[model samples]
Target: MAGIWAISCKPCELACVRQEVHARDAEAQLVRLASSDNVLSLIEADAGVLAGMLCSTSDLADDEAVSLIERVAKLVTCPLIVMCDRLDPGLIARLFYAGATEVVAGGSSSSCEPVSSKEACAKGALRQATSAGAVAHSKEPAKSASGMDAYAEPARQVHDRTAFHYASSMTTALDEPDGLDEPDELGRSDELEEPDEIDGLDEVASRKAMGGRSTSSEPGAPVICAIAGRGGVGTSSVVGLMAATAARMGLRTAVIDLDLMHGNLPALMGIDDPVDLARLLKDSDSVSETAIEATAMMVSPGLTLWGSLERPELAESMGTAVEQLIFALRDPADVIFIDTSVAWGDAVAAAVAMCDRCLVVGAPGPTQPESAARIAQLAARLGVARTKMVSVLNRCTASSLNEEFALRFEMALSLHSRVRIPDGGSEVSGLLSFGRLEDLARGESRLTSAIQTCTSSLLKELGCAVPEGFGKPSEQDSGGLRIRLPWDKAGEPR
Candidate 1:
């Protein structure tokens, strides 16, 4: 049970009951709550011992009174007690709702005849509280002052400044209630109950369930994933393959081709047209599901591709649009893949920074690993974590994975999967240009199988559905056009 605590208890009658309880419950401590003068000083001196607080009603009206209280509120994870003189009904309601565990009367008169103005003030406060619908839970009231020599100096220091005035011939009697524990003991009881209530993974799973494939808006979700590599290294192709894999497994995936200068997803994916992504983000309210649908062509169940817009001049205007589109797709997307431009630019960097993960794709070559490593280093400097990144080794065949070939290329990216494009000769480029990448998820092609295996592996890692078709990608396939590898080739540079 939580320890019962009160503040400014110098005149309090309940101290006796508190002391007895403290004596009876060897493990428990009855306590006095903290006041402004000492609470902040103590918190600053030893932050760890601090738990929570109860604000006195007088301090709420005085802005400086809660200065320490507000600061503590932001730091500590414990609950607060709200001790009031006469709480505003509205204020009381809001306080309780905002995590105040209990509210109790703080200053009140305990005697037959109230002598001091402060006593009259406290009793009036009690009446005001009663009028505001608060119950009189504390049976006894606090005692008032005797002569000028009465109070202990430390007790008087609770208020910031004091200007004392003596009443004509008033003398108030005070007897410390048997042995009430002070405020510190009360805070200790609360600290013991808090950790278990807060330290669970319920929030993460709920957010993932609501926000597509990524976990909630918390610290875990990798919002940004970049695909960066040398020119003509199949970067866009890998993005389409990854997006296709996500969609095939029932994810509402979006493939955003960010290569404004020479974006070919629209042409490469065979759309042969332009979709105004920049315009959609500029006029966000007008951009809805229908607008996004028009901007992105559906390739499979829960998957869509936003073809590149025509004027390369409009690339600068596309950044905000991409941001808006990502925000809008939060609940709908299981995976969002961005196909980066050939050269790293502000837009490409911005896209990489925005994603939860990055997939740097490269072909079997000398410079690929070095370029990928530079990209990884920059990402690391910017605070991207190792787990949030993976390298994609595209178009690798058994020949590409061989010891001699691997010796020449030192891999830098996540090489868990490799993409393959058959030598369909001249028409291969034309056919690939118009085809939606989604076909790879269902077709009887080597490329399709390679992509499916990669998707299954990713979904399993992220705790998503594991379809029966899921299989592991291997280091080699003797004659196939494509084979996945878990490690980068030897020569590309580590």
Candidate 2:
């Protein structure tokens, strides 16, 4: 509750004042706002309470008080009640100027003995408090005491959440090689948008962002990232890891698992199962940020997730998901991961166009030459620059046969930055079995090292500052490889 400072007041006076404050729910909402050495603390805060501390009058520190008032005003989300011991026109005026939403005199009409000049002071403070409350209650929606309307009530503000924090201690899972089914020659998976179908990438981007009909004013480029590959290749795992890492790095990271084929990122990351995306699509107009965001549970203070839908048909409604997905990423997250499917449909193409980075994961197979080629060619057609693209070699192995896979795949490898991932082995099993990779990232796992090196390299290329201890970790952590005793399967190959 908001404090009413006592200055040599009689016992009766304290009881009378206490009764008045306890009677009003608004007064109960505000607690004391304390500032000392430039640090302010709000105590016993009620969402709608108004609070103010006493300022001396004889010396008339109006300018100083005004500055304090303005700063404090920004903190209170509800209307303010400014209490003064004695009403002075100058003080009242200064309070308003300094951003006190309301000002009043503090006192009661009763038989309490007066303390130091308290008789006058008490009356004035009561008057100000009463006036402040009345004025605030009359205003439409009652602007918070600080008179801040926008972002004034932070706890109440809501939006769809994405999980992509640049966290320090999370694993970045690599998906298996992407698979491609041969279609007609015109089935060019490489070209997200057939050049002839749309005039340019901007045109397709415009349509995808607008969803054919967003009347709201255009917003900044909606934050998005594309995590895609074929079924069972762990597209969501990579998406989850990106989100986990981003969150740890202090960026509010979010993951929008657009994998309508099989929604597992939420479960894999140990988050809640998703609500129906098709149902959300049907009610797209009603999909307010608050409702949509509620679907995601915060993995940490910095990370959150908006999971994917379960049904195969849910992907059919992806056209609408793209539109809303943009709004979800606007939160203060460092990164946004969009886990997608292997089938390169128009929906996937639209997502690829909007992403800041496109990571394609693949394994070493003779067909990888052809599959990677199709992905790179399609990405190029979509106007994705070579610099913005990344190709990760998942579960890489060297077979005696087809010894020159890298050379043959040079055509696809030339299109973007490349990271050769090492076998995560048990780390992968841990993520799948335990639903967390914190231990794996902390261990001296080759895959973890590769992820740390590669992700930082990509970040540096993207012009973002390289994070600390990324490629450099404590020896006990990931910096140095562990030397196990001979009995501990020490020589086993990953």
Candidate 3:
């Protein structure tokens, strides 16, 4: 049974279409969108096809619709189909370019012409001729050339393999209600529900069984600082992934976006108003668990995020405040991953100096080797142990290039690179790329396997015992326990 989530204006024709689709496809589960603001939350909650129905042409021109489609295509790795009154060639082309899987036409004037047999025969051709009769009278410019001519066929070939179906029937519209309320800062809605536990793995009990100790008695959580030799080498992405990996393992994990100048962790994690580090740091006495909880945004189970401050001037004042917050969170979280800035600053240096383990991510480029060496020098100067520092080669797949990365690491930083993450390509690249990577980690892939190995290595470095079957579904099934506690809804500690 396919699940279809349809988004339309309130009191629009989508209600009828939803019912008809459910009737036609008995097994299909149809979910309607309540508001445009909850797109990410809805995507995370539901797993299936997304159908955006635009009844009026004006609705197609709405910025919200276009933005919604673009974000869904980029962030949600699912099939996106747009249902409209007529097939506007330019709009269809742009939608495809924006990542829509298919476009369907319906309404009173359903005169959609089938693709020409000759045009269909052409390999990887996407550009179809505009409707000659009706399109001539329309305002849109004529694009008579093959759609495939302008757009690259090979890039879209994978997406074009599937067939499309247009809805020919119309339904009565419903009464229009007041506008939907604005979405929460985190984009959470009351409609969103918690995800199922990972294969019945009792997170707390399993950790207890392994004799994992709480950090409450200590002053700080285990800090894993992911530093990069240069910017745009996928360092932030790696940090975000590591944090997610740990959180999924049921370790209380928090990701602090220390990249004040150009931080995108909030965007990557789909958090709108993540903890304002600058504001939180203003009060010297506000480093308590309550304060942290009030400021931080909960991303998922066991995952919390402290996003960067927009003001770069606050970076100087943040050195002590950041350190204090790190210490404060120790009792609440088991692990804290810091996404440090690209350049070496006082704050970055302070963070590196304070970290229990440092992951230096360097690209396979000209200056990255020297940059790695500089990081090593700084770590050594700050009295960090050599064994605690690990190096990673980001986005290099070729064997020869990996070897060069290894050679560079050892020669420059006196550290042999342990992890080399392959560029997962377009299928895994986007604003919410970390979520996609986390999904990939659930399945069998070289990337997941590598991530597992790296995680194990880091745990060993931290003197934590690796379970017999880490990152796997536990054999123990407790028959699905579901006890509702007062704070269970928010997943916050009492």
Best by lDDT, which number?
A: 3
lDDT of 2 by residue, 180-292 (tens): 11111111123323444334343333332222111122222223354433444445655566556555555555667666676676677765455555555544343433444
What is the C-alpha lDDT profile of model 1 across 308-344, one tens digit per residue?
6666777766653554455445434445677877565
In model 1, which range of ten residues has the least summed lDDT? 145-154
Candidate 3 lDDT tens digits, 1-494: 36454554334555444533432234555555556555557665653444322222224464555566666654543334454555454554455344443333433354322233122212212222211000111111122111111111111101121111111000110111311111121112222222232111121111111111122223224678888767877777788777777665656677888897678887777675656667766455434334444557667666778868778777766754565555445444556789988765555655665565678888767788888778765554442434346678766663346565657765676542356666555655752554454465455545555666677557544533345466442222112123557675578865
How should the candidates be ordered by lDDT, best one leading? 3, 2, 1
For each predicted model, how many residue pairs clash, with residues at least 3 apart or on different chains?
A: 35, 52, 3
Q: Looking at model 2, which ten-residue stretch has the lowest summed lDDT?
A: 179-188
What candidate 3 gets wrong by more than 4 Å, as runs, is 1-220, 284-290, 398-402, 431-437, 440-443, 465-467, 471-494
The candidate, 2 or 3, that scores higher on TM-score is: 2
